[model samples]
Target: MPLTTRRRALSTLGAALAGAVALPAGQALAAERTPPVRPLWRAHAHNDYEHPRPLLDALDHRFGSVEADVFLVDGQLLVAHDAVDLDPARTLESLYLAPLAARVRAHHGSVYRGARTPLQLLIDLKTEGASTYLELDRQLSRYRQLFTTYTHGRVRRGPVTAVVSGDRAARTPLAAQTVRRAFYDGRLTDLGSTEASFAALISDNWTSHFTWQGVGSFPDAERLKLRTIVGAAHERGQRVRFWATPDVPGPARDALWGELLAAGVDHLNTDDLAGLEAFLDAHGTD
Candidate 1:
Protein backbone atom coordinates (compact mmCIF):
# COMPACT_ATOMS: atom_id res chain seq x y z
CA MET A 1 0.00 0.00 0.00
CA PRO A 2 1.03 3.63 -0.50
CA LEU A 3 2.68 5.31 2.50
CA THR A 4 -0.10 7.92 2.72
CA THR A 5 -2.82 5.31 2.62
CA ARG A 6 -1.06 3.20 5.25
CA ARG A 7 -0.71 6.17 7.59
CA ARG A 8 -4.33 7.14 7.21
CA ALA A 9 -5.36 3.61 8.03
CA LEU A 10 -2.98 3.59 10.97
CA SER A 11 -4.40 6.84 12.34
CA THR A 12 -7.95 5.60 12.15
CA LEU A 13 -7.07 2.20 13.53
CA GLY A 14 -4.92 3.71 16.28
CA ALA A 15 -7.76 5.97 17.43
CA ALA A 16 -10.11 3.02 17.61
CA LEU A 17 -7.57 0.82 19.38
CA ALA A 18 -6.71 3.50 21.93
CA GLY A 19 -10.32 3.88 22.91
CA ALA A 20 -10.93 0.15 23.03
CA VAL A 21 -7.76 -1.00 24.81
CA ALA A 22 -6.77 -0.30 28.37
CA LEU A 23 -3.14 -1.28 29.02
CA PRO A 24 -3.03 -1.47 32.78
CA ALA A 25 0.08 -2.89 34.42
CA GLY A 26 0.40 -6.68 34.34
CA GLN A 27 -2.92 -6.97 32.53
CA ALA A 28 -3.16 -8.15 28.94
CA LEU A 29 -5.44 -6.39 26.46
CA ALA A 30 -6.87 -8.41 23.61
CA ALA A 31 -5.04 -6.76 20.72
CA GLU A 32 -6.55 -9.28 18.29
CA ARG A 33 -9.97 -7.83 18.93
CA THR A 34 -9.07 -4.60 17.14
CA PRO A 35 -7.55 -3.96 13.76
CA PRO A 36 -3.82 -3.31 14.06
CA VAL A 37 -2.33 0.12 13.40
CA ARG A 38 0.99 0.59 11.69
CA PRO A 39 3.26 2.02 14.34
CA LEU A 40 5.48 5.08 13.84
CA TRP A 41 8.70 3.10 13.86
CA ARG A 42 10.75 6.25 13.43
CA ALA A 43 9.06 7.95 16.36
CA HIS A 44 11.14 7.31 19.53
CA ALA A 45 10.04 8.48 22.94
CA HIS A 46 13.01 10.08 24.75
CA ASN A 47 12.82 9.86 28.55
CA ASP A 48 9.75 7.70 28.10
CA TYR A 49 9.50 6.87 31.82
CA GLU A 50 8.70 10.48 32.62
CA HIS A 51 5.40 10.29 30.80
CA PRO A 52 2.29 9.98 32.94
CA ARG A 53 1.96 6.27 32.17
CA PRO A 54 5.49 5.27 31.25
CA LEU A 55 5.60 2.49 28.62
CA LEU A 56 1.83 2.44 28.13
CA ASP A 57 1.75 6.04 26.89
CA ALA A 58 4.25 5.29 24.15
CA LEU A 59 2.30 2.21 23.15
CA ASP A 60 -0.90 4.24 23.07
CA HIS A 61 0.86 6.72 20.77
CA ARG A 62 1.89 3.79 18.55
CA PHE A 63 5.58 4.58 18.95
CA GLY A 64 7.93 1.76 18.06
CA SER A 65 10.75 2.85 20.39
CA VAL A 66 11.03 4.15 23.95
CA GLU A 67 13.98 5.15 26.17
CA ALA A 68 14.36 4.61 29.90
CA ASP A 69 17.17 5.83 32.14
CA VAL A 70 18.01 3.27 34.81
CA PHE A 71 19.99 3.69 38.01
CA LEU A 72 21.16 0.66 39.90
CA VAL A 73 20.58 1.36 43.55
CA ASP A 74 21.21 -1.48 46.01
CA GLY A 75 20.19 -4.44 43.82
CA GLN A 76 17.11 -3.09 42.08
CA LEU A 77 17.21 -1.12 38.84
CA LEU A 78 15.27 2.06 39.46
CA VAL A 79 13.87 4.21 36.66
CA ALA A 80 14.61 7.91 37.05
CA HIS A 81 16.43 10.77 35.39
CA ASP A 82 18.47 11.61 38.48
CA ALA A 83 19.39 9.85 41.69
CA VAL A 84 17.65 12.44 43.81
CA ASP A 85 14.37 11.81 42.06
CA LEU A 86 14.57 8.04 42.30
CA ASP A 87 11.47 6.37 43.67
CA PRO A 88 11.79 2.88 45.04
CA ALA A 89 8.28 2.10 43.87
CA ARG A 90 9.30 2.73 40.26
CA THR A 91 11.40 -0.14 38.97
CA LEU A 92 12.54 -1.38 35.61
CA GLU A 93 10.53 -4.56 36.03
CA SER A 94 7.29 -2.93 37.15
CA LEU A 95 7.60 -0.05 34.70
CA TYR A 96 8.88 -1.80 31.56
CA LEU A 97 9.80 -5.50 31.44
CA ALA A 98 6.78 -7.12 33.03
CA PRO A 99 4.32 -4.84 31.30
CA LEU A 100 5.98 -5.39 27.92
CA ALA A 101 5.91 -9.13 28.45
CA ALA A 102 2.19 -8.98 29.11
CA ARG A 103 1.51 -6.81 26.07
CA VAL A 104 3.64 -8.98 23.79
CA ARG A 105 1.75 -12.05 24.96
CA ALA A 106 -1.58 -10.40 24.25
CA HIS A 107 -0.39 -9.39 20.77
CA HIS A 108 0.70 -12.98 20.09
CA GLY A 109 4.50 -12.44 19.98
CA SER A 110 4.90 -8.93 18.57
CA VAL A 111 4.56 -5.83 20.75
CA TYR A 112 2.04 -4.47 18.28
CA ARG A 113 -0.70 -6.73 17.05
CA GLY A 114 -0.18 -8.08 13.52
CA ALA A 115 3.20 -6.30 13.32
CA ARG A 116 6.40 -8.28 12.86
CA THR A 117 8.87 -5.64 13.97
CA PRO A 118 10.22 -5.77 17.51
CA LEU A 119 9.75 -2.77 19.77
CA GLN A 120 13.02 -0.98 20.59
CA LEU A 121 13.61 -0.49 24.30
CA LEU A 122 16.58 1.82 24.77
CA ILE A 123 17.76 1.25 28.34
CA ASP A 124 20.16 3.97 29.45
CA LEU A 125 22.30 2.91 32.41
CA LYS A 126 22.83 5.69 34.94
CA THR A 127 25.25 4.00 37.33
CA GLU A 128 28.64 2.32 36.93
CA GLY A 129 28.37 0.28 33.78
CA ALA A 130 30.18 -2.95 34.68
CA SER A 131 28.40 -3.76 37.94
CA THR A 132 25.12 -2.24 36.81
CA TYR A 133 25.09 -4.23 33.59
CA LEU A 134 25.72 -7.45 35.51
CA GLU A 135 22.52 -6.81 37.41
CA LEU A 136 20.78 -5.80 34.22
CA ASP A 137 21.88 -9.02 32.51
CA ARG A 138 20.49 -11.05 35.38
CA GLN A 139 17.20 -9.19 35.20
CA LEU A 140 16.91 -9.48 31.42
CA SER A 141 17.51 -13.23 31.64
CA ARG A 142 14.24 -13.66 33.48
CA TYR A 143 12.44 -12.29 30.42
CA ARG A 144 14.68 -13.87 27.79
CA GLN A 145 11.68 -15.06 25.84
CA LEU A 146 10.50 -11.47 25.46
CA PHE A 147 13.76 -9.95 24.21
CA THR A 148 15.84 -10.40 21.08
CA THR A 149 18.72 -12.62 22.07
CA TYR A 150 22.24 -13.24 20.88
CA THR A 151 23.50 -16.77 21.30
CA HIS A 152 26.91 -17.92 20.03
CA GLY A 153 27.04 -15.89 16.77
CA ARG A 154 23.34 -15.82 15.93
CA VAL A 155 20.61 -13.31 16.83
CA ARG A 156 17.05 -14.44 17.48
CA ARG A 157 14.30 -11.92 16.94
CA GLY A 158 11.76 -11.44 19.70
CA PRO A 159 8.96 -9.09 20.72
CA VAL A 160 11.31 -6.41 22.09
CA THR A 161 14.91 -5.50 21.28
CA ALA A 162 16.71 -4.05 24.28
CA VAL A 163 19.69 -1.84 23.46
CA VAL A 164 21.90 -0.86 26.37
CA SER A 165 22.96 2.81 26.35
CA GLY A 166 25.04 5.06 28.63
CA ASP A 167 28.14 4.09 30.67
CA ARG A 168 30.69 2.84 28.18
CA ALA A 169 32.07 0.43 30.76
CA ALA A 170 29.12 -1.86 30.14
CA ARG A 171 30.71 -2.84 26.83
CA THR A 172 33.32 -4.95 28.57
CA PRO A 173 30.91 -7.44 30.14
CA LEU A 174 28.64 -7.36 27.11
CA ALA A 175 31.54 -8.34 24.87
CA ALA A 176 32.55 -11.13 27.22
CA GLN A 177 29.14 -12.75 27.10
CA THR A 178 28.58 -15.58 24.61
CA VAL A 179 24.83 -15.11 24.96
CA ARG A 180 23.00 -11.92 25.88
CA ARG A 181 19.43 -10.61 25.89
CA ALA A 182 20.43 -7.06 24.98
CA PHE A 183 22.63 -5.28 22.42
CA TYR A 184 24.98 -2.36 22.93
CA ASP A 185 24.14 1.18 21.81
CA GLY A 186 27.10 2.34 19.72
CA ARG A 187 28.42 5.81 19.13
CA LEU A 188 29.68 7.27 15.83
CA THR A 189 33.19 6.05 16.64
CA ASP A 190 31.93 2.47 16.98
CA LEU A 191 30.26 2.53 13.57
CA GLY A 192 31.38 -0.39 11.38
CA SER A 193 33.80 -1.41 14.14
CA THR A 194 31.50 -4.22 15.29
CA GLU A 195 28.86 -6.48 13.81
CA ALA A 196 25.19 -5.50 13.93
CA SER A 197 24.62 -8.35 16.40
CA PHE A 198 26.83 -6.49 18.86
CA ALA A 199 26.16 -2.85 18.06
CA ALA A 200 22.71 -2.56 16.54
CA LEU A 201 22.33 1.18 16.89
CA ILE A 202 24.54 4.20 16.13
CA SER A 203 23.62 7.16 18.36
CA ASP A 204 25.24 10.50 19.09
CA ASN A 205 24.51 13.93 20.48
CA TRP A 206 22.93 16.08 17.78
CA THR A 207 24.67 19.26 18.96
CA SER A 208 28.11 17.71 18.80
CA HIS A 209 27.95 17.16 15.06
CA PHE A 210 25.59 19.81 13.71
CA THR A 211 25.18 23.53 14.32
CA TRP A 212 21.78 23.64 12.67
CA GLN A 213 18.95 23.78 15.22
CA GLY A 214 16.22 23.82 12.56
CA VAL A 215 15.84 27.63 12.74
CA GLY A 216 17.49 28.35 9.37
CA SER A 217 18.67 26.62 6.25
CA PHE A 218 20.69 23.51 6.97
CA PRO A 219 24.28 23.87 5.88
CA ASP A 220 24.96 21.88 2.71
CA ALA A 221 28.09 20.36 4.24
CA GLU A 222 26.34 19.30 7.48
CA ARG A 223 23.41 17.85 5.59
CA LEU A 224 25.81 15.74 3.58
CA LYS A 225 27.61 14.75 6.73
CA LEU A 226 24.39 13.65 8.38
CA ARG A 227 23.40 11.59 5.38
CA THR A 228 26.88 10.12 5.15
CA ILE A 229 26.73 9.01 8.79
CA VAL A 230 23.33 7.43 8.26
CA GLY A 231 24.49 5.78 5.04
CA ALA A 232 27.58 4.32 6.63
CA ALA A 233 25.56 2.87 9.52
CA HIS A 234 22.88 1.48 7.20
CA GLU A 235 25.53 -0.09 5.01
CA ARG A 236 26.67 -2.07 8.02
CA GLY A 237 23.04 -2.94 8.95
CA GLN A 238 22.94 -0.62 11.98
CA ARG A 239 20.14 1.84 12.69
CA VAL A 240 20.86 5.51 13.57
CA ARG A 241 19.48 7.87 16.20
CA PHE A 242 20.66 11.34 17.35
CA TRP A 243 19.56 12.71 20.71
CA ALA A 244 19.86 16.25 22.19
CA THR A 245 17.97 17.74 19.26
CA PRO A 246 15.67 20.75 19.70
CA ASP A 247 12.46 19.02 20.84
CA VAL A 248 10.32 22.02 21.76
CA PRO A 249 6.98 22.03 19.96
CA GLY A 250 7.57 24.35 17.02
CA PRO A 251 8.54 24.65 13.36
CA ALA A 252 12.20 24.29 14.32
CA ARG A 253 11.67 20.83 15.74
CA ASP A 254 9.51 19.86 12.77
CA ALA A 255 12.14 21.13 10.34
CA LEU A 256 14.87 19.07 11.96
CA TRP A 257 12.61 16.02 12.12
CA GLY A 258 11.78 16.45 8.43
CA GLU A 259 15.43 16.64 7.51
CA LEU A 260 16.19 13.58 9.60
CA LEU A 261 13.36 11.71 7.89
CA ALA A 262 14.66 12.83 4.49
CA ALA A 263 18.12 11.60 5.49
CA GLY A 264 16.61 8.18 6.20
CA VAL A 265 17.45 8.34 9.88
CA ASP A 266 15.85 5.37 11.63
CA HIS A 267 14.58 7.03 14.81
CA LEU A 268 13.34 10.52 15.64
CA ASN A 269 13.89 11.12 19.39
CA THR A 270 11.30 13.24 21.17
CA ASP A 271 9.78 13.61 24.62
CA ASP A 272 6.55 14.89 23.10
CA LEU A 273 4.95 11.63 22.03
CA ALA A 274 1.74 13.30 20.79
CA GLY A 275 3.66 15.97 18.90
CA LEU A 276 5.86 13.46 17.09
CA GLU A 277 2.87 11.24 16.37
CA ALA A 278 0.93 14.13 14.87
CA PHE A 279 3.96 15.22 12.86
CA LEU A 280 4.49 11.73 11.48
CA ASP A 281 0.78 11.41 10.71
CA ALA A 282 0.71 14.72 8.87
CA HIS A 283 3.80 13.73 6.91
CA GLY A 284 2.13 10.41 5.98
CA THR A 285 4.84 8.29 7.54
CA ASP A 286 4.68 4.52 7.51
Candidate 2:
Protein backbone atom coordinates (compact mmCIF):
# COMPACT_ATOMS: atom_id res chain seq x y z
CA MET A 1 0.00 0.00 0.00
CA PRO A 2 1.13 3.58 -0.62
CA LEU A 3 2.50 5.54 2.42
CA THR A 4 -0.06 8.36 2.02
CA THR A 5 -2.95 5.91 1.68
CA ARG A 6 -1.85 4.16 4.90
CA ARG A 7 -1.55 7.54 6.70
CA ARG A 8 -5.07 8.55 5.61
CA ALA A 9 -6.53 5.22 6.78
CA LEU A 10 -4.87 5.59 10.21
CA SER A 11 -6.14 9.20 10.54
CA THR A 12 -9.72 8.12 9.66
CA LEU A 13 -9.58 5.37 12.34
CA GLY A 14 -8.22 7.89 14.89
CA ALA A 15 -11.04 10.38 14.19
CA ALA A 16 -13.66 7.62 14.61
CA LEU A 17 -12.13 6.61 17.95
CA ALA A 18 -12.01 10.22 19.14
CA GLY A 19 -15.69 10.75 18.27
CA ALA A 20 -16.71 7.59 20.15
CA VAL A 21 -14.73 8.67 23.23
CA ALA A 22 -16.30 12.15 23.19
CA LEU A 23 -19.88 10.81 23.36
CA PRO A 24 -21.65 11.40 26.73
CA ALA A 25 -22.56 8.28 28.75
CA GLY A 26 -26.19 9.29 28.96
CA GLN A 27 -26.25 10.27 25.30
CA ALA A 28 -24.73 6.92 24.36
CA LEU A 29 -27.50 5.22 26.34
CA ALA A 30 -30.09 7.40 24.61
CA ALA A 31 -28.77 6.30 21.25
CA GLU A 32 -29.21 2.66 22.29
CA ARG A 33 -32.62 3.12 23.95
CA THR A 34 -35.55 1.23 22.49
CA PRO A 35 -39.00 2.78 22.24
CA PRO A 36 -41.35 2.03 25.10
CA VAL A 37 -43.73 -0.90 24.65
CA ARG A 38 -47.30 0.24 24.01
CA PRO A 39 -49.45 -0.50 27.04
CA LEU A 40 -52.64 -2.57 26.40
CA TRP A 41 -54.92 -0.19 28.27
CA ARG A 42 -58.15 -1.94 27.22
CA ALA A 43 -57.37 -5.40 28.57
CA HIS A 44 -59.05 -6.12 31.92
CA ALA A 45 -57.92 -9.22 33.74
CA HIS A 46 -61.07 -10.57 35.35
CA ASN A 47 -60.43 -12.33 38.65
CA ASP A 48 -56.75 -11.47 38.43
CA TYR A 49 -56.09 -12.84 41.92
CA GLU A 50 -57.15 -16.32 40.81
CA HIS A 51 -54.00 -16.66 38.71
CA PRO A 52 -51.09 -18.57 40.24
CA ARG A 53 -48.81 -15.49 40.39
CA PRO A 54 -51.65 -12.97 40.79
CA LEU A 55 -50.59 -9.37 40.05
CA LEU A 56 -47.20 -10.32 38.61
CA ASP A 57 -48.82 -12.36 35.84
CA ALA A 58 -51.02 -9.49 34.64
CA LEU A 59 -48.22 -6.93 34.87
CA ASP A 60 -46.05 -9.17 32.74
CA HIS A 61 -48.78 -9.09 30.07
CA ARG A 62 -49.04 -5.27 30.31
CA PHE A 63 -52.68 -5.41 31.34
CA GLY A 64 -54.15 -2.02 32.33
CA SER A 65 -56.92 -3.22 34.66
CA VAL A 66 -57.11 -6.08 37.19
CA GLU A 67 -59.96 -7.26 39.42
CA ALA A 68 -59.74 -8.65 42.95
CA ASP A 69 -62.66 -9.99 45.00
CA VAL A 70 -62.47 -9.05 48.68
CA PHE A 71 -64.34 -10.15 51.79
CA LEU A 72 -64.34 -8.19 55.03
CA VAL A 73 -63.72 -10.65 57.80
CA ASP A 74 -63.07 -9.43 61.36
CA GLY A 75 -61.92 -5.99 60.14
CA GLN A 76 -59.47 -7.52 57.68
CA LEU A 77 -60.03 -7.25 53.92
CA LEU A 78 -59.25 -10.67 52.44
CA VAL A 79 -59.06 -11.23 48.67
CA ALA A 80 -60.95 -14.16 47.16
CA HIS A 81 -63.76 -14.88 44.71
CA ASP A 82 -65.96 -16.47 47.35
CA ALA A 83 -66.21 -16.68 51.13
CA VAL A 84 -65.43 -20.42 51.12
CA ASP A 85 -62.15 -19.77 49.28
CA LEU A 86 -60.97 -16.88 51.46
CA ASP A 87 -57.41 -17.21 52.79
CA PRO A 88 -55.92 -15.25 55.66
CA ALA A 89 -52.62 -14.83 53.83
CA ARG A 90 -54.40 -13.24 50.84
CA THR A 91 -55.35 -9.97 52.44
CA LEU A 92 -55.92 -6.92 50.20
CA GLU A 93 -53.05 -5.00 51.79
CA SER A 94 -50.55 -7.82 51.23
CA LEU A 95 -51.51 -8.92 47.73
CA TYR A 96 -52.28 -5.50 46.17
CA LEU A 97 -51.53 -2.36 48.19
CA ALA A 98 -47.95 -3.15 49.22
CA PRO A 99 -46.91 -4.43 45.82
CA LEU A 100 -48.57 -1.50 44.02
CA ALA A 101 -46.82 0.99 46.31
CA ALA A 102 -43.47 -0.71 45.71
CA ARG A 103 -44.07 -0.69 41.95
CA VAL A 104 -45.04 3.02 41.84
CA ARG A 105 -41.91 3.89 43.83
CA ALA A 106 -39.79 1.78 41.52
CA HIS A 107 -41.31 3.36 38.39
CA HIS A 108 -40.90 6.92 39.74
CA GLY A 109 -44.56 7.74 40.52
CA SER A 110 -46.22 5.86 37.63
CA VAL A 111 -47.32 2.27 37.16
CA TYR A 112 -45.64 2.26 33.76
CA ARG A 113 -42.35 4.05 33.26
CA GLY A 114 -42.58 7.55 31.69
CA ALA A 115 -46.39 7.41 31.69
CA ARG A 116 -48.76 9.61 33.67
CA THR A 117 -52.02 7.63 33.39
CA PRO A 118 -52.69 5.26 36.29
CA LEU A 119 -53.53 1.53 36.18
CA GLN A 120 -57.00 0.45 37.25
CA LEU A 121 -57.47 -1.71 40.35
CA LEU A 122 -61.05 -3.00 40.42
CA ILE A 123 -61.98 -4.07 43.98
CA ASP A 124 -65.11 -6.22 44.11
CA LEU A 125 -66.59 -6.27 47.57
CA LYS A 126 -68.21 -9.60 48.47
CA THR A 127 -69.23 -8.53 51.96
CA GLU A 128 -71.36 -5.78 53.51
CA GLY A 129 -70.81 -2.66 51.37
CA ALA A 130 -70.68 0.18 53.89
CA SER A 131 -68.66 -1.64 56.55
CA THR A 132 -66.24 -3.16 54.04
CA TYR A 133 -65.64 0.14 52.23
CA LEU A 134 -64.85 1.90 55.55
CA GLU A 135 -62.16 -0.67 56.28
CA LEU A 136 -60.89 -0.50 52.70
CA ASP A 137 -60.69 3.27 53.04
CA ARG A 138 -58.58 2.88 56.18
CA GLN A 139 -56.22 0.52 54.37
CA LEU A 140 -55.98 2.89 51.39
CA SER A 141 -55.27 5.86 53.64
CA ARG A 142 -52.11 4.20 54.87
CA TYR A 143 -50.64 4.34 51.36
CA ARG A 144 -50.95 8.17 51.21
CA GLN A 145 -50.86 9.11 47.49
CA LEU A 146 -50.81 5.65 45.95
CA PHE A 147 -54.40 5.51 44.61
CA THR A 148 -56.31 8.16 42.62
CA THR A 149 -58.47 10.57 44.59
CA TYR A 150 -61.68 12.46 43.71
CA THR A 151 -61.33 15.70 45.65
CA HIS A 152 -64.07 18.34 45.51
CA GLY A 153 -65.04 18.44 41.80
CA ARG A 154 -61.83 17.18 40.21
CA VAL A 155 -60.04 13.83 40.00
CA ARG A 156 -56.39 13.84 41.04
CA ARG A 157 -54.69 11.09 39.08
CA GLY A 158 -52.23 8.84 40.90
CA PRO A 159 -50.23 5.68 40.20
CA VAL A 160 -53.35 3.51 40.46
CA THR A 161 -57.12 4.01 40.18
CA ALA A 162 -59.30 1.83 42.38
CA VAL A 163 -62.85 1.22 41.06
CA VAL A 164 -65.30 -0.39 43.50
CA SER A 165 -67.52 -3.16 42.11
CA GLY A 166 -69.93 -5.79 43.53
CA ASP A 167 -72.69 -5.36 46.14
CA ARG A 168 -75.29 -2.95 44.84
CA ALA A 169 -75.68 -1.47 48.29
CA ALA A 170 -72.14 -0.11 48.19
CA ARG A 171 -73.28 2.59 45.74
CA THR A 172 -75.19 4.44 48.48
CA PRO A 173 -72.11 4.97 50.65
CA LEU A 174 -69.66 5.39 47.74
CA ALA A 175 -71.84 8.15 46.33
CA ALA A 176 -72.00 9.85 49.71
CA GLN A 177 -68.23 10.17 50.11
CA THR A 178 -67.05 13.80 50.05
CA VAL A 179 -63.50 12.69 49.28
CA ARG A 180 -62.67 9.05 48.53
CA ARG A 181 -59.84 6.97 47.18
CA ALA A 182 -62.07 5.02 44.77
CA PHE A 183 -64.92 5.31 42.27
CA TYR A 184 -68.03 3.10 41.90
CA ASP A 185 -68.74 0.65 39.06
CA GLY A 186 -72.32 0.87 37.83
CA ARG A 187 -74.58 -1.51 35.92
CA LEU A 188 -76.19 -1.13 32.46
CA THR A 189 -79.21 0.57 33.99
CA ASP A 190 -76.99 3.42 35.17
CA LEU A 191 -75.37 3.94 31.75
CA GLY A 192 -76.88 7.22 30.57
CA SER A 193 -78.33 8.31 33.90
CA THR A 194 -75.08 8.16 35.92
CA GLU A 195 -72.26 10.69 36.07
CA ALA A 196 -68.66 9.74 35.28
CA SER A 197 -67.40 11.42 38.47
CA PHE A 198 -69.39 8.98 40.61
CA ALA A 199 -69.53 5.89 38.37
CA ALA A 200 -66.35 5.63 36.34
CA LEU A 201 -67.26 2.39 34.58
CA ILE A 202 -70.37 0.50 33.47
CA SER A 203 -70.05 -3.31 33.70
CA ASP A 204 -72.70 -5.98 33.14
CA ASN A 205 -73.16 -9.63 32.27
CA TRP A 206 -72.91 -10.08 28.50
CA THR A 207 -75.23 -13.09 28.53
CA SER A 208 -77.97 -11.09 30.23
CA HIS A 209 -78.19 -8.48 27.50
CA PHE A 210 -77.29 -10.19 24.23
CA THR A 211 -78.24 -13.64 23.02
CA TRP A 212 -75.53 -13.95 20.38
CA GLN A 213 -72.83 -16.05 22.06
CA GLY A 214 -70.14 -15.30 19.47
CA VAL A 215 -71.36 -18.27 17.47
CA GLY A 216 -71.52 -18.10 13.64
CA SER A 217 -72.18 -14.37 13.35
CA PHE A 218 -73.51 -11.74 15.72
CA PRO A 219 -77.12 -10.79 14.99
CA ASP A 220 -77.34 -7.41 13.25
CA ALA A 221 -79.66 -5.90 15.83
CA GLU A 222 -77.60 -7.25 18.71
CA ARG A 223 -74.48 -5.66 17.24
CA LEU A 224 -76.38 -2.41 16.89
CA LYS A 225 -77.52 -2.66 20.50
CA LEU A 226 -73.95 -3.23 21.68
CA ARG A 227 -72.70 -0.22 19.71
CA THR A 228 -75.56 1.88 21.01
CA ILE A 229 -74.68 1.04 24.58
CA VAL A 230 -71.02 1.85 24.04
CA GLY A 231 -71.81 5.10 22.26
CA ALA A 232 -74.15 6.20 25.03
CA ALA A 233 -71.56 5.51 27.68
CA HIS A 234 -68.85 7.35 25.74
CA GLU A 235 -71.16 10.29 25.25
CA ARG A 236 -71.75 10.40 28.99
CA GLY A 237 -67.97 10.30 29.62
CA GLN A 238 -68.00 6.74 31.01
CA ARG A 239 -66.47 3.44 29.89
CA VAL A 240 -68.21 0.13 29.11
CA ARG A 241 -67.33 -3.47 29.99
CA PHE A 242 -69.36 -6.69 29.93
CA TRP A 243 -68.51 -9.96 31.68
CA ALA A 244 -69.98 -13.51 31.20
CA THR A 245 -69.23 -13.50 27.46
CA PRO A 246 -67.43 -16.37 25.77
CA ASP A 247 -63.89 -16.86 27.18
CA VAL A 248 -62.97 -20.25 25.75
CA PRO A 249 -59.91 -20.36 23.49
CA GLY A 250 -61.44 -20.45 20.01
CA PRO A 251 -62.66 -18.28 17.15
CA ALA A 252 -65.73 -17.39 19.21
CA ARG A 253 -63.70 -15.41 21.77
CA ASP A 254 -61.83 -13.64 19.02
CA ALA A 255 -65.02 -12.72 17.20
CA LEU A 256 -66.63 -11.37 20.34
CA TRP A 257 -63.51 -9.38 21.19
CA GLY A 258 -63.33 -7.99 17.68
CA GLU A 259 -66.92 -6.92 17.93
CA LEU A 260 -66.24 -5.32 21.30
CA LEU A 261 -63.32 -3.41 19.86
CA ALA A 262 -65.31 -2.23 16.84
CA ALA A 263 -68.01 -1.04 19.21
CA GLY A 264 -65.46 1.05 21.15
CA VAL A 265 -65.87 -0.84 24.43
CA ASP A 266 -63.33 0.52 26.87
CA HIS A 267 -62.31 -2.71 28.62
CA LEU A 268 -62.29 -6.31 27.44
CA ASN A 269 -62.91 -8.60 30.45
CA THR A 270 -61.10 -11.94 30.31
CA ASP A 271 -59.69 -14.65 32.57
CA ASP A 272 -57.20 -15.98 29.99
CA LEU A 273 -54.30 -13.54 30.12
CA ALA A 274 -52.20 -14.73 27.18
CA GLY A 275 -55.20 -15.33 24.96
CA LEU A 276 -56.47 -11.78 25.27
CA GLU A 277 -52.97 -10.39 24.97
CA ALA A 278 -52.46 -12.20 21.67
CA PHE A 279 -55.85 -11.05 20.39
CA LEU A 280 -55.22 -7.42 21.26
CA ASP A 281 -51.76 -7.52 19.67
CA ALA A 282 -53.02 -9.04 16.43
CA HIS A 283 -55.63 -6.27 16.13
CA GLY A 284 -53.20 -3.51 17.24
CA THR A 285 -55.70 -2.12 19.75
CA ASP A 286 -53.04 -0.83 22.15
Candidate lDDT values, in order: 0.93, 0.88
- Candidate 1 TM-score, C-alpha based: 0.89
Candidate 2 lDDT over 178-199, as tens digits, reads: 8889998999999878888889
The clash tally of candidate 2 reads: 0
Tens-digit lDDT track of model 1 for 140-256: 999989999999999999999999999999999999999999999999999879889999999999999999999989999999999999999999889999999999999999999
**Runs off by more than 4 Å, candidate 1:** 1-31
TM-score of each: 0.89, 0.87
